[model samples]
Target chain A: MSITSLPETDRSVPLNRNRRSALIALAGLLVAEVVLGSIWKILPQNSAVSPNVFTALMFLMVPPILFFIYDAIWGIKSRNSKMASYPMMLIALGVFVLGTLWTVMFSFTNIKIIPLFTPADWVKGFVGLANYKRLFNTSRWMDCPGLTKAFQSGWEFKCAGALPNMVTYAVLSIAISVSLGFLLAVMMDQKIRAEGVFRTIFLYPFALSFVVTGHVWAWIMSPEYGLQHSIRALGWESFSFDWIANRDMVMYAIVIAGIWQGTGFVMALMLAGLRGIDDEIWKAAKVDGIPAWRTYIQIVLPMMKPVLVTTFVIVSSGAVRIYDLVVATTDGGPGISSDVPTRYIYQNFSANLGQSLSASTVMLVAMAVVLIPWIRVEFGKKSQA
Target chain B: MANTSTISAEPSGAKPKPFITWERAVVYTVLIVCALFFLLPLYIMIITSLKSISEIQGGNIFVPSSNPSLAAWEKAWNSACTGLYCEGIKVGFWNSIKITVPSTIVSIAVASISGYSLANWPFKFSEGFFTILLLGSFIPYVVMLYPIVIITRYLGIFSTLPAVVLVHTIFGLPIQTLLFRNYFASLPQELFKAARVDGASYWQIFFRVFVPMSVPIFTVSVILQVTGIWNDFLFGVIYAGPTNYPMTVQLNNIVNSAQGGKAYNVDMAATILTGLVPLTIYFISGKYFVRGIAAGAVKG
Candidate 1:
């Protein structure tokens, strides 16, 4: 049940043999998998589906096997009893089957499960890198008619491709939303009256799904009948706010709506971080005659590193998988100017399955880049502390 | 800090107190402006929904409607066309509830048990699987969408609420597991030790000791899960066939579809209707929702 209640002798029982055996098994599996993978890799370039499927299956098991190796080093400990290990193994196996295995399989291959009885189309030939090439249009740029003009003018909005547009959208939205949220948090931290009301107002949007947000913003941003129309009716005849209709500026329009929906949650997170700070710090700064802004910048902000990192991760991940917002707002319109990766994947999945798979694979890589470091830093700190 | 009552309170021992000051005015202005920016869409949606279509087209967006009406709201709830059906989001309301309730319960149940196991029983390589699962959470759902479709089809649950629920459970495992694991881990080791000493088995301890003591975190998980499952669109759209589409997906179809004249009022009402569940949860849960976000955001 608990660490302190474990019998002294039982607690001292070394897991030497258990660890050694697990290590040997893990090593044997790793060597076998690698050798088999290489052997399969050496098959003729046009080889049959079996070897490819085998390689994919091999890749799928690598993470779980690696986990086995890790478990080898870290002995399984249950309160006072070795019985727990058996149930734990069963549960781990269940999780692998349910959670890890399918995603690994799906991300690697293009499987068609229709025509229920047929197994022929189930395992498609490995078209490694081909799908990805289609997504990035790796070779198409060479034949692009406006290539020299685009190069001369510099990479304008969507000048490169959907991938670059997505990258830009993610970066810009994260930057803007986080900075705005921080600014709002600072204001809210001034200990003003009606803080609860203000907080609720800011956060209500976050609670609503992106679909609702996207529609509202789309309406608000529409040129003919939205903010522009209303403002123009107020006697500002020359007024025009048509970013939503303009291809070059459409991404910014989407970014604005994203920031609107997202900033509130970021504010809530930041405000919590602000409140967690010691009140004494402020008094100390006051006694030292430090300006409030400087106190925030030089003293308080640096102290909120953990909160900042958490907020950054939340906002950035939101930026990464921003589909509903774009779908509701632009639907990647005005000739695909506001298209994001998720939308691109959604629209193309049925018609262009391989390209869509490749796009998602690209997204997987992007997600790893964003998530891996945070996971390390987060878990790494906890283990150390 | 308390001595300076409103921003106008002068430093003690310095000069006469002013009733109002530039700083106070600036603070009020900024807070009000920000509040207005946040409320603008809600205000617009409400007024637009209430106004007659001609009144909406009349374009006095900020003005109170001369004849406020519930017609749009009614139409949105009971009569607006969503795809082939003239019946509105009401058709999908039951579907959303059906998906959300079961999905929330099953996901949270799995999460709580798995969390307990990971926390109390530290099996060999648990951390490795935990890490992999955590990493799996970050992979965009788009990557898994088609795969899941195929898998669900193969399992014969495709185009059903069960399929959506299953997908939600799988995708939701990491965070829910993390929440429960963290909550359970924070429990005093003494309680667990005492339970084990008293011969409480794993499930017995989890049920008797862990579950009872963990209601606060449980409530937090419920709020997060209910809102998440209810608000989901992509899974609801793709997995739940036309007959079973959730409110968000149906709402999107109704409001954004290209067919027929743009019924702005109906669209506004539909948007509000879809948003109401989460909004209600937010307003009702109050601090729990905030705590849930905080809990969800930071690792401890």
Candidate 2:
């Protein structure tokens, strides 16, 4: 219960004083954490972060911690355990945040398979742009046939690495999924018969993991006993749909699988967006004698900017972080032709720490670029309203 | 979803069903075709999983097996090998259950509590803490992978079940917290105030009043987390490691492993088995699944 809810005599000056001191102590802890966080940021790139320092920091918080525990127990007796969750929130901040910050910091280092974050390995590990330079210069990373890499110097861009493949995957998947999703959503919105059945069928793939989707599609795309065999067995005798095996067509195969897995969710989101539109808009358009197609195109579609943005963000995020699908399907086969950025980072994580982290840093940058605009549009509108 | 019932310009129940219009036929035709495309993989999965090796090799992928047997399913469950091990995918299935149950419960508990506090308590830095949590949700797991590995190793839980659980909880925190916080915040303030006037403590009001009123949101959260965690491949592959590989990881291994001759039937069986959990949830928790996804998408 709140202090104000306490009976006048129960809420004594001493109790109020205790509450005030506890608040002051918490304020102190907050200040200390802020100081520590800044110190963490300023620490040398390659310098080892000792666990002992964290222990010492924990040592400093013991008194306030004990007081909070004591207060929570006291709260249990008198029903005032509001502060029970304060530590949990701190844990979220600590557990959820440290790894990200640490990864970003370690991105500047040149560690190998073993991480160099500990004090023992903190010797001359910092290499500013070396990892990035190597990452970019590597033929595998920089080479693609017709995309961004192809425009660069031909001699250098030999191997079409994960980077170009990732770009291709993201761009193609995002565009295809959004459009296909929108189209399906519009058709579903027609209020056709057995709508639930249609919706259920459309969205079931989304419930499956990328691994499941990848393998299922991999089987379907397999040249030997898959569709090619099935079609040829139907007496066509000449069906050559081996996209999954062809290096040039493998990425497209992955893209198609990605679309099948993701477009339904996009459709669901778009459908929600469509349903959320005020019916009055439709009525208004109808009163103006506008055709149904024109109303949807010229009127309803623009009204769905928020939903479109949300779908874009969701689909694009899925597209970028498409490691599992690739691993389960092609395993980045045919010499890493279907590799995405996240998969590249994951592979390198076991082999080259510096390269893995540099790749991760690039992903982090891309993520930031994608999110900032959406956050502003989303939260900015909320704040304004 | 679009409510383009705009064609007739009639309001509500007054609108008449058009008589065999070409557009209607076209819409139904497209929907049926799209439905086929969507259902084809799952259909193929089931049929292939049921087929024996000979039947599958006989050809015609679309056709059901004439002599469908449980042999592939049994092999997938009890003998499918991922490289050296041939204990089937049952190990991974049970491991997934272990991972999913605890991860779902613990993450929901921690996130809901923290969310409740953030919504009602309104401490000085709640917004700042929330901002961090929000940003945490958006940060790609790849970016956080190495550091998490280090932390997990430092904690000596790396490559173990608890490490996977911890990682899931950490990643699940932001969105789960956001879901609960928004749900709680949208609730009427009067109930909270009434409880306060009656001298009820935080936990009392939460359990007594709020919990009863929170069925839908709780269901939504569960659906989101259950599917989300069940479908997790990266964390299972990494933190769970080889010994504790979850079903998705194991399924991938069984299918993608380059060992003896390919076992397409067994692989498909294992894939279906891996997918069954979330598929069951999707079919059962249909509306809540939709609501959960919409909420997840709209979550800031």
Per-residue lDDT for B110 in model 2?
A: 86
lDDT of 1 by residue, A1-385 (tens): 1111112222122233357656776788788788877786777876633464556557656765765666676754352222333233333344433333444444345532222213343255444555555555642211233654675656542353466667777898888878888988888776566777887998899999888998998888888678888899999999989999998788788888888888888888787777777778988998899999899999989988778876777677778888888888887778777777887777765666656666676777777688655666566655574
Worst 10 residues of 2 chain B by lDDT: B1-10
Each candidate: chain B TM-score: 0.91, 0.93
lDDT of 2 by residue, B1-300 (tens): 232234324435456867789999999999899999999998999999888888888868999988888899999999888778999999999989999999999999888887777676655556677777776666777988888788777755789888888888888888787788777776787787778778776688788988899999899898899899989999999899798899998898888674666788999999999999999999998888887887756533
Could you say which candidate leads in DockQ? Answer: 2
Q: Rate the local accuracy (lDDT) of all candidates.
A: 0.74, 0.78
Chain A TM-scores for all candidates read 0.68, 0.76
CA error at residue B78 for candidate 2, angstroms: 0.6
Q: Tell me, by lDDT, which candidate is best.
A: 2
